[model samples]
Target: MLQPKLKSKVRCTDRDIGEVTKVILDPLSHEISHIVVSMNGSGERQIEMAQVQDVMEDRVELRAPASAIAALPLFQRHDYVTTHEVEISHLEDNIDVTPGEVLVPFPDLEKDVKRRTFFMNFTHVIAFLIGLPMAYPILRFLMKPMYMPFDNDWLMVGNVSKIKQDDVGVQFQYMKKVKEAYMPEAEVEKSVWVLKASPEVLDKVYQDKDQEFRDASGRIIWINKKDFPYIAFSGKCPHLGCAFKWRQHKTLGQVFLCPCHLSIYDATGSVLDGPAPRALDALPIRVSAGGDVEIIDMEFKAGVKSQIRII
Candidate 1:
């Protein structure tokens, strides 16, 4: 009986040639016919069993010289076919087995199945490793807003003495610290329009004394006490959130105008003309005894009648 081991060194008569990579067997007889040897530098070749002198535990000695084996044809793998798919004429005559006994003549088929399984598992592992790094940044960026705190703290914007009753609207720019997940804390410039109005003017703009500003979920966001003389409006317009300017119009006189659209507002931040959905958004204000104006800077959803706080 000849037992050929894969990866066994193949030694020619002159020198060591290569190693055995595969053993080809006769399907019916279950006997070895050819062995595929992988050469060190010349690639793989098929060697016939007739040239094999002896098969040992770890090596196979050949009767031919190194030059003769080097000239052999290269080994090629054939496509597999199942026994039930093809008809063999002499399969029964060659086998002398008892009745109701099955014979499995192919051992290399199990090795091929195992190789494919290992390849698939290796591919999945590599794919997971590559995808993990790419997905981390996107997940962090999306969840950053959830972990951030809302800007509800009062920030000192300007002095009340500078905003006079004669002025239509005064623009006050202040530096605010912004928080970002991927970057360090940085200061950004923010601005708001301040208007000084009388008691009658404020009452006309805010008609409903019980009117309340709420968010999208119907939760009350803010309610004016009508105590402060200085009214501060958000720089963003309600119609599409464009920056509005306090300008002198030819027909409308002193009004807040948005250059993007023709949305206009009066000194009380009430929508006077154009496509503005509602009055300009207002923020909570506080006046110190020393005349310092502190206001809570906030943002709201645009193009809606309701005042929905965004941040």
Candidate 2:
């Protein structure tokens, strides 16, 4: 009469193991026979009910230690870390009929029968040989979301006083190290634009601007005069991930213009007019003691109204 919940945390005598993925049951007796726990990505182990020492406080404890459990015959599932050819073999094993198909479809029983008995067909064997090496990188890319850690690292971009008030805005580019899934870190250059609007200009600019940018109580979203007093935004366009520039026009005076698709943004990083879903991404910045501006360089999910940080 055991009822082990799916995905419950499992542990060994010495250390924590993994979560229960599936509970194998004997249908005739309605008894739990095995607990399938995924140790990590691409590795699973089946724990017999006999080895489960206790199942209290929402955790399954094992009789064996972690090292002992790892050495067990059932724990040595194919991770393919030792070899790449195993991944190609796994890809060729997923040709079974899906449950979504109706009327069982027209049976390719002859071909499927050969695959089930021999584990692979001639075509699959040939494909595995031709594409075995490339499958490793593809598998890493597919599993990136599960492996990559979420982190936000701050880097100083530039000094605020260095950008003249008349310059309107300036773009800063810096090297960023991106950690790839199952790969080493990579150095890539990224850019950000700092909009330099002095308190004098901001006083006149937003004095009579849109009331919608403020709360119902009439407090403006863009504070006129703040410390450091420099506005910074990601130079990437929200729509199509294109590089945008700050350009001044005869009537417009100064605006963030996207040359790729003609999206326009105002001084406070609000969408003025264009097909852009949202405004430019404003960065987190602060001023130093000597009137210098230091910015925490980070990126957000592009083409999204609510800015979600992506680092």
Candidate 3:
């Protein structure tokens, strides 16, 4: 029985180094008169001293040295030596085993591992330390509170009791704050009213009649209230709080005239002629429980064409 031919397969790192396979023979065996060698994956074939037809089926045929086959580290036994035809077999099928080796290209493993671990740990510590201060300002700003003193804690009223009813000048005491020991304290002063009108006078004063008042300096001071009884507003200009005396315009009827800037106020405390944002402020007062009179709280806001409406 004729022995079956064998083949081997191998992988080479450098393609420039080709492949080889061996056929073991006795000292006096049939001389390899004409041998055929073929590269398997490439399907290229070559013959020594023989034409292509001379080989058995022109496939699975190779002749090479055993030392050349051993040099390739990555190789398969069955792919090494196979006859072109008849009894095509792998070298591993005939032989029990074939040796193998593998090589990989890389730097030293210990140094590479230590470098990577050190860099990662260093970055982690830096991030933790830096994040503490950065978050402090942000947290402080978000958790802080605001300050407001006069939010919904005060009330305002009108002062009309300062005017009298019998047309007689009346005297009243007014209390104002003065510095006491570097702190503010109440100080009293007496102010005298010159003209007094009864509650019924408001109806007549607000009528179509033009009424005006003035101080000793002939400066227009007061204008009679509109559509009311015994109610009137000071003719002081609010822009700079300049006092004005009331005067009857020979042709214009009645007008309050300011001496400092000649600012004028209408009967309703509205700025009739000046650069003020709004009308004069109203004083707060009311009839006392004892049937006398009392002055209450007074506060004001400025606006365009607005007046301190005594209500």
Best by lDDT: 1
Q: What ranges in model 1 sit over 4 Å off?
A: 1-144, 180-183, 208-223
* Candidate 1 whole-model C-alpha lDDT, 0 to 1: 0.76
Count: clashes, candidate 3: 33
What range of 10 consecutive residues in model 2 has the weakest lDDT sum? 97-106
Kindly indicate the candidate among 2 and 3 with the higher lDDT.
Answer: 2
Q: Candidate 3 lDDT (Cα, whole model)? A: 0.39
Clash totals for all models, in order? 0, 1, 33
Off by over 4 Å in 2: 1-149, 199-228
Q: Give the TM-score of each candidate.
A: 0.51, 0.45, 0.29
The Cα error of candidate 3 at residue 311, in Å, is 18
**Weakest 10 consecutive residues of candidate 3 by summed lDDT:** 97-106
Per-model root-mean-square deviation over C-alphas:
18.5, 21.6, 28.4
Q: Count backbone overlaps in model 2.
A: 1
lDDT of model 1 at position 215? 48
| Model 2 deviation from native, Cα RMSD in Å | 21.6
What TM-score does structure 2 among the candidates reach?
A: 0.45
Could you tell me which residue pairs clash in candidate 2? Answer: 160-293
